[model samples]
Target: MPNIQLIAPCLWFDDQAEEAAEFYTAIFSNSQIVNITRYGEAGHEMHGKPAGTVMTVAFELNGQPFIALNGGPAFKFNEAISFQVICQTQEEVDNYWEKLSAGGDKTAQQCGWLKDRYGVSWQIIPNILLEMLNDADTTKSQRTMTAMLQMKKIDISELLQASAE
Candidate 1:
């Protein structure tokens, strides 16, 4: 048997668990749908789902395991919790941002954070941004933060320039 991750995030969705899983798998390179469980006639009372309806979808994004559940609209994804994707280059950041935010909420995009079409929040951050923000020079760090706050998609070159100034 394949070794399973100790912990995995379970996403609650109204009825788009499979769709969301496919969307996410397409976005990440080393991703795939591991398994899918459907609702059976045994528990139609509590779940209110017909037999054979998709109840859960197990997937992996870049090797990180996640389970998407069709648990009705009782819960939603909010900014309080987010998955951060650290990119080594600007091209990587741009690629993820463009693909993840294709049909997402435009207004929610700020400081490299965006809400996807399925309402999941993602932070597309550059690796250098973290280093610059944690640098000993407060001026450089502050400048980088200020520059970052003013943009939706993170620009690594702009951050470098701001930090130098």
Candidate 2:
């Protein structure tokens, strides 16, 4: 048996597994497509995909393994499951937010959460946001939360100012 991690998230897509894998690998550093699996004659009736068509693309992002599966239209991604990207700097948050949200649904954006073109929800969050929200000072945290609720993409400086206030 091949060595595998304990858990790996599988992203279901309607025949866009390879495309999503490539897009994700390009966005994050130290990421790449690890393997590709294709459909075969077996189970053709149920799957309805042609033989040799991409069935799954195994990939990694920042060393976390994931699989993009061409699972057809029976299922879809929802905001209930989101990948939270904890960034240490404002630039990192902005970079990830811009790339992940491109060509995505604008109406889905709220409080640093966005649905990508592939319908995957991502939370581009600054690390300091958590610290501020968890602060012992209730007033500071409440103010920060209020400021965060009004914006789609989180601004670190604005959050800092809100907490100070």
Candidate 3:
């Protein structure tokens, strides 16, 4: 037998790392908290305080593994890199988009691009997008791409319309 384990995504938060982890776990199915480790007494950096103050939390989301670290203010999530979620239907897109865009600024793009309250960027796109963009006709793909470039949250119906000559 071979020993194999899946790697998990690590996310750093200023102060709401735990809160964010909880929120995310609640949103996705087949997700739960694995562990919550706090700092130790005589902490190296957080000395003389409650050592274990949610140092780390392991959780799963829709079978995807993730780890949240309660690190001090050092780095913040920017719009440079974002997570892209492929949805099967319009309902899935709407569900995720609505929740993630609740307190964030929204820019209507062709495909889908949304920024959350934490300034983190996300893409809520449909799985069919790939097929539409990879159409045999180059012009169709180009049109779809153009449409996506103009909007923030991608609407599948619109993409289809744009791709259809």
Candidate 4:
């Protein structure tokens, strides 16, 4: 592991760290729950959690380390930061879009972005979207960008057709 990844991202949840960790592990491939720590009687007064209640969950998603904290509802997820899942095929994009967006805010979806049930935003983007949008031909790139702007989940076929010379 590199020093950069040693500082893994920590996600905050309102008393749902274990549940969220389980959900994420189930969704992403090559993932597992590493460890879980629960609150004890030693700090119940400061933490406000009952003894043995889950305080933190450490897990990895697609080999990337992550920590889920059972923090209170003083914070909420917004669009300012999001994890980007770059996919090589439409099938991959569609699968992630369907699973992650289940029970999520549908109206918030636009241009390959969706907010999961936990309110964490994700971008299920097709790798081709970048290639097409970055094409040397300005017209094709513009067309590809326009087509991408019209859909919630990325469609590689449409993006390819839009960029066709």
Residue 66 miss distance in model 4 (angstroms): 0.3
Off by over 4 Å in 3: 1-3, 46-49, 107-111
- Candidate 2 residues 4-43, lDDT tens each? 6999999999999999999999999999999999999999
All candidates' lDDT scores?
0.96, 0.96, 0.78, 0.91
Q: For candidate 1, write residues 1-165 as lDDT tens digits.
A: 989589999999999999999999999989999999999999788999999999999999999999999999889899999999999999999999999999999999999999999999999999999999998999999999999999999999999999999
Report how far off residue 130 is in candidate 1 (Å). 0.3
Per-residue error for 134 in candidate 3, Å, reads 1.2
Model 4 agreement with the true structure over 7-104: per-residue lDDT tens digits: 78899999889988999899899999999998889977777888888989999999899999998888999999899999988789988999999999
Q: Which regions of candidate 4 are displaced past 4 Å?
A: 1-4
Clashing pairs for model 1 are: none
Ordered from best to worst lDDT, the candidate numbers read 1, 2, 4, 3
- After superposing candidate 1 on the true structure, give the runs of residues whose Cα lies further than 4 Å from its correct spot: 1-3
Pairs that clash in candidate 4: none
As a TM-score, model 1 comes out at 0.97
Candidate number that wins on TM-score, 1 or 4: 1
Measured with C-alpha atoms, the lDDT of residue 113 in candidate 2 is 97
